[model samples]
Target: MTDTAPQPIDLDALPEEDDHDEALTTFRARVGAFELHWSVDAPLSVVMTSSSHVGRAGVGLIEVLTSAEQRGRTSQAYWRSAVGERLRVQGSHITSDGGAERAVIVQTDAVSGLEVRSTVTAPRGTTALRIESVVRNAGREPVVLTAVSSATIGIGRSSSDLDRVTWGSAASEWLAEDRWRETPVRELLPDISLPFHGQDGRGHAGVTSHGAWSSGEHLPCGYLVRGDGEALAWQIETSAGWHADLSQTRNGGVLSLLGPTDLEHQFAHELLPGESFTAVPVAIAASAEARDGVIAGLTRYRRWLRRDVAGEALPVVYNDFMNTLMGQPTTEQLLPLIRGAAAAGAEVFCIDAGWFADPAIGDWWSTVGEWREATARFGEGGLRRVIDEIHRQGMSSGLWLEPEVVGVDSPAAARLPDEAFFQRFGRRVQEDRRYHLDFRHPAVRGHLDATVDHLVEEYGIRYLKLDYNINPGAGTERNATTAGDGLLAHTRAFQDWLVRVQQRHPSLRIENCSSGAMRADYALLSVTHLQSTSDQQDFLLYPPIAASAPASILPEQCGNWAYPSSEMSDDETAFTLVTGLSGRLYLSGFLEELRPAQRDRVAEAVALHKALRGELADATPFWPLGLPAWDAPTVCLGLRTGSGDLLFVWDRDAAPAAFTLPDVSGEVEVLFPAAPTDGSGWRLATTVAGLSVATSAGLGARVLKVRRG
Candidate 1:
């Protein structure tokens, strides 16, 4: 291997020009694999390579320079080599148009020896260029390096005339105090103009620092910002080993790439003295749905990078037949109950808990992983009978399985022996309500894989509600030392098993539940379709829960609704049903216990939700009204598709109180669900021009449907 470094070429002597001209000499352009000398103004040239492995086009490499004068305010540029095969660039430059200057620079490295190659294309009539980078590393040594793709936008007369920037991701955050992480792009920048600042005084309020890696106390990374003025630009810097940043400035907002820092740290490789490493970064521009399209495209790219990850699709609705129909009913009994629910507007008949071998188990503390049919309770082939019954009723069957825990007296405990479960200090470790399973153990994973496969293939179960009853303990060293890779491996393996199972059935859906909503995370979201919002089933508690969820998630992925339990009042039940109607609704009650009139009320509520599912999915709730329960009357309003909309109000006590609505105007219709018929009856009154209400306080329960007139 040669120890000599390639001679550094000085870019200071490059010429500056407003446009490329044929007279330009000293500049070289290469397309695909082949290289040829050409003038600056010449139509883009094409080249082919020798290796069929390189395919028809292989990769594209271009090197160009003008007189140093045209380079503009050239900032810092330095070269460093840690692995000996790649060259890293660290610096910034200034570009100006119409007297406004913007900073731009390349934040990563260029490599010649790469497991994967990339292609670049620039079509006419587009303001932004496109680059596509693909890598497939099969070497013993992992490849480790940051990929920072940068672009410079010419300052225009107005920011509105420029392309808008939008990002696609499940979550985003600003580097606040190094320990802080925020979700949802809107929260990170409540105001579009204020830059988001970090502890080190590096971020601006309206600006978003998309990606970063901590180097002890300092953060080396990239950020993106939208330019409402004229010019927009960006920079990415990596100090130690790996980093990534994709930045763009358009009319809407600035979108960029963040996180996945751990991927670079773990997978980057080192080059032998004489070997070479290559890196490619791509950027594409679309005029419509830019953010969604970009995010979707990036998701596809990441999935391809991770070996084409695909999740099972299962859509379902929750209802009260499980607990009410026949608590732990036999297969013969449960089948009809499930069929009844299917006929009563349930698309997926979910037989929640209490269906296994032991009813004595409480709080999920025992009987997990028993995976046996309750022959006494379910009759023979009970599970299969229920599944078949659901299919016959024109619906899919979903069964609950808490595979991450085991009971002290479970058959699995005796059958697998102590070595199979997680242990600490010679004692089995317990968490929350159950004994934790050592997923790090291949044997444990194998057991779950076999069980799930059997359930899916034998019973024709299309939806599996996999519940985890315990919190993860301090993982074993064998798993922890893997940099959470063991946990990630367990997750990937579980997903891989599901994928294989899905390939066979092709209609399986998986819902992940971990002692309610505690395990809600990106990793889980990537694998499962729906998440159990929380164990708090009372419908009255949903508003607070829904509000708190935005702190960590998007509402679309969150499951919340009104569930009528045996302990609620008539007024409480109406409130619960109405509030839950605004979300992904689920029910848990005794259908037989309801009076005929009450049953009709529930049917109407369910029907309303089914009809407005599209609107609810897309609707955003305005600020809540009234104090918690402290205020006499509690009200919540959510705008539907039209400008004038619906209002839900509940009166907790007997006293009458005044209320106000914000951001609303014009005529309104207030429909009272219930009210007193006497002279002391609830009345319709208005305190403001845009506000009006119909009263029914004496009525046990009421729904005032208000619309602006």
Candidate 2:
């Protein structure tokens, strides 16, 4: 007789029992292909699991124990998973036997899988639970798979009034058998059709418009929209591309797909049957607080999650005001720019990319090792003078440093032989105009520390813009042993260096940029202040780029505006300025190039932004009204403050038509300027109970700042 012990078919098929009868809510079981355990404490639960086939071949085994919870009031959830060989639990927190709780493990059963482990302690007032899962492949065939342990929350009802559904193009067609139909959410207010482009080419279609709710057949994710009120939801989906999908009932939230939209980061493997893989998916829930609360909660939880796995800080928005180095900048020219920006209300004046030495520009790269300014550029005591000037302007001074990059012909490169650099193939590879520095070396860390220390102690530099301009080489093909994992190791090590450096200089802000969008992960966000969305400084592209930014990225972190450039029109420029007002504003254009009227317009816009800064930072973008057309006019509407009661409208064209503010009630104040050119020149239209009329006639722009009376 065959020994049939009823083996589990899949890891999730494992039976779990809720022991509410016990003093501690405990759950322990050996599921189909793995072992799992969980316990709950009010709002949170603790879990632990162990499995050998949890990843691909040559990948290490995964032993993770974590705490998961649904936070109350805040409308957020929390998760902290620690990965290692052994899982040890003490009360609510879990750690590895070696106490290396924050380590990340790469596992492969038949294919590659990554597991990041960490611990989560309950927040000050919340109750908590512990949950853990061990997933393994008990089959003989290699399997390419994406596995995620997810917790979903459904508030109120799950029907049409509370939930709505939409499908991607592929998913929509597949569901056509069921007569899947789509309606525009903006139809109720036809005058406010949102101008947006969906993936592929089809515009957004509301799948639940007929007051119905449905789920995606293949994807396990879904959406819910409240009927009378607003609805907000967040989901972390893992496929070939890891993405965090944040959507709401009123407007389409953000779908932040990792890597590039065109490129696929597939977690493929030839699974040898019994091999298993695990992906951690994080989901959070909250009431309708304009989604800002959701973003804040998620930001907090992500920070906590990353801290548990890696003891580092995430990036923050450290705005820089300087332009890129097509050429060198003298202290005299740079100082005035910094001072002017400070006077213009910039908190941080960053001296951008060109501050360092580059031989191509007639000046030899001098500061790569010294971290001091080249005297020839400043005439005397360059860096200190610049720093002092920034302080005098009542703003923080920041300097850009690409520490991981070394110019091949630089003196620093000549002094440090091939051993100190990362080599590809046989010869030392060069990406762009620089060679990579091996941060894994202790000597390298020491050098970076010293360089940062000099800037902090000598010049009172409080912000550092660290730009990684190159990609990683083939680890295995580049060098044997752990050197193959240099990309991973360097990232981890660089984070460590950041933590240590920040500890020594607690006030210093660090912004990370890898040619722009690269290296923007939860791991890096924890340690730095901001991540550059792109290298291109064209304001024309800011709207689309910003529209794509996920809610996970705080309004403050969005890199919206660069500088005062002439490439864009006054209306286009105004649009860009308005978009940037919602995020960290960085200036890059030369003020000297602006015409008198343009300068005045720029100054007024900046002042207006300052006045409405709080509202712009706090409000959520509903739908974009259309872009300005050559024939007709265009307007952009946004809700500002007052729990959906206030509205802000921007007339983007020379000729403005009447705009009906949507869903606004009570007495409201409408503000617009008589002379659009005058910063302080405004004409107070009537204070109306519901809606008001405003007009614009000339080529400039107009802003209607409406507030509930």
For model 1, how does the per-residue alpha-carbon lDDT over 330-423 read when each residue is reduced to its tens digit? 5655654565455446677777776775444434346667676665566666567667878888877777887767887677877775655655
Which 10 consecutive positions of candidate 2 have the poorest summed lDDT?
207-216
- Where in model 2 is the C-alpha error above 4 Å? 1-164, 167-327, 358-372, 414-429, 473-485, 531-536, 547-550, 565-576, 592-661, 664-709
Residues 583-688, candidate 2: write the lDDT tens digits. 4555556654566655665666566655655554455444233222222243343434543323334443455456544344454443322254454322334433
Reference-based lDDT, each prediction: 0.40, 0.41
lDDT, model 1: 0.40
Cα deviation at 116, candidate 2, in Å, is: 10
lDDT at position 181, candidate 2: 19
Q: Candidate 2 versus the native: TM-score? A: 0.58
